[model samples]
Target: MNIKITGTGSYIPNEIQKNEDFNNHQFFNENGSKIEYSNDVIINKFKKITGIEERRYASAQQNTSDLAFLSAQKAIDNANIDPETLDYIIVAHNFGDVDMNTSQADTVPSLAARVKHKLKIENPYCVAYDLLFGCPGWIEGVIHAQSFIKSNMAKRCLVIGAETLSRVVDKHDRDSMIYSDGAGASIIETTKDTGGIISTISASYTLDESNFLFFGKTYNKASNDEKKYIKMHGRKIYEFALNYVPKAMKACLDRTRFDISDVKKILIHQANEKMDEAIVNRFYGLYNEEVPEGIMPMSIQKLGNSSVATIPTLYDLILKQKIDNHQIHKGDILLFASVGAGMNINAFLYQF
Candidate 1:
């Protein structure tokens, strides 16, 4: 049985924060109260170096689950599937709502319940849950969903990739200057004779080696609005993206019983344009160094890095702008790859 994606949807913050915002004023750490800057000198310097004009920010009012729910609804509507027909829902993210009953421990049930109630999904029961491993979370959602359908545990599922990176971005640091908030969802409905994710490969290295780029908290159950922010070894992360992406991509291609030539197009986690270029360049023998435009960049210059949501958001963009032109034909192959906080790298081959 092939689990195929029938629809796609995404939601980004309504507000846009420009380069000037950082240059205009100084911000203090919510806990330490340490100031980041005294003036606009450094912000301009960053503008010249990174070429980022603006980025998105989620309001203090919105939480990760709220964004995930909206994206799921959009995907459901796009698929035109009766909300009642979905057997399960998976919301992927590093953050979750702050409720004792919100969602935790096991993601499969609590997440399903949250989406079922919030969307008013009627008739059929929905199994909701979360996947918290990090950026690899989204592709893992697809692999996990496929297994459920294979075992007859579910007939149809909605796999969501959601992120609120803006909530954790360290505005004080210029290394991670590009970051924003967004949510994306892809409809994965079960069918024995169709196209979908055909292969998925995951590999994790030592955490101590890759925890160089990460965010931590003052307390275990830290508030998102607290002094919560990201910390990173920028140089280290850039190196990881370059090193891990090709290995994972090749491993996925191998699992799917195909080569780079078998892939019509590739979708990668969009950490930055520089990193995207590095990976794309390596496939010169496979793709001729010619990655079709609008696919690789992920339009991240404006959206920044949306974490788990980045690849799905890029997929949505690909569908909206190019599906009708070159097209995802019957039996076509698609690939998804990512590396996140846990230092895990994952790749998947989709037939669509």
Candidate 2:
């Protein structure tokens, strides 16, 4: 049975946060003390290094579940399937539904359950749950869906990755500028045809687990309100991406016996443009070939890093021909890869 992605959809907030938006603003360290840095130099470095000029931030009135609902409905409609027909709903998110004021995440209902209720999916048989695998959550959700379909446990599944990073990011921290909010979803079903998800794999290393990335409620003396913030070591992550990400991609391609030339697009996690470009170039180096231009489509310039939502959203945009200079044709091959907080890495090979 082929696990086919029948439809895809994504929703990004209308509120744009530009690079210049941080000018002359005070930033704080983890201890909450203010740190002085040239805003122009920081913005210029961000633009030149990450290629991110702007990103979207969800409004205070919106929640992660809200973003998920919109994208899920669009995907369900695109799939032309009744909501009741879905056998599973897998929502991948990091912080669940964190409020803008408190930065506290609520996980009791599970984001998947919240989406199910919002979508009016009444059937109890349609199992819905949340998966947390750092930024690879969405890809991991797709992997689980494939397993369910292969084992005859499910026929059709809706996989969604949604996040409101704006709610958790520390406004007083520079890293906050790189986080945003968005959601992306896909409806996958079992099909008799061959072209669909070809191969999937995931792995994790915990050596630097606590240092690389984390999210929690922490106090900032600069702000009157308490907030949960994302913290990370950029240099550490960059090194990890350059080393392990390419290895993971190679493992997936080798498992499927496909080469760099066989893939049409490489939709990777929109973390850093420089790191992503380096990883792809290094992957091609493994084959003693130069990296090809236009093979890796990037939306990080506009979307920033929406974590789990990045790859699926990019995939949807390309599939719908919404992204200029990028299009997916029938029989096109694609490779999706991501690395995140758990020190986890994953990859998938697919054919359109």
Highest TM-score: give the candidate number.
2
Candidate 2: clashing pairs of residues: none
- What's the C-alpha lDDT at position 272 in model 2? 89
User: lDDT per prediction?
Assistant: 0.70, 0.89
TM per prediction? 0.82, 0.96
Return model 1's CA RMSD, one decimal. Answer: 5.0
The runs of at least 3 residues in candidate 1 whose Cα sits more than 4 Å from the true structure, single-residue gaps closed, are: 25-51, 98-112, 122-125, 217-226, 283-297, 322-331
Clashes of each: 8, 0
List runs of model 2 lying over 4 Å from the truth: 29-36, 216-226
Give the alpha carbon lDDT tens digit for every residue of 62-160 in model 1: 766777788888888888988888888888887654332222223334554676778887755677777876777888888888888879898888888
The candidate scoring highest on lDDT is 2
Least accurate 10 contiguous residues by lDDT in model 1? 98-107
Error of 1 at 254 (Å): 1.9
> What tens-digit string does per-residue lDDT give for candidate 2 at 120-216?
9889999999999999999999999999998999999999999998887766677777888999999999887779998999998897654699764
- Candidate 1, lDDT over the whole model: 0.70
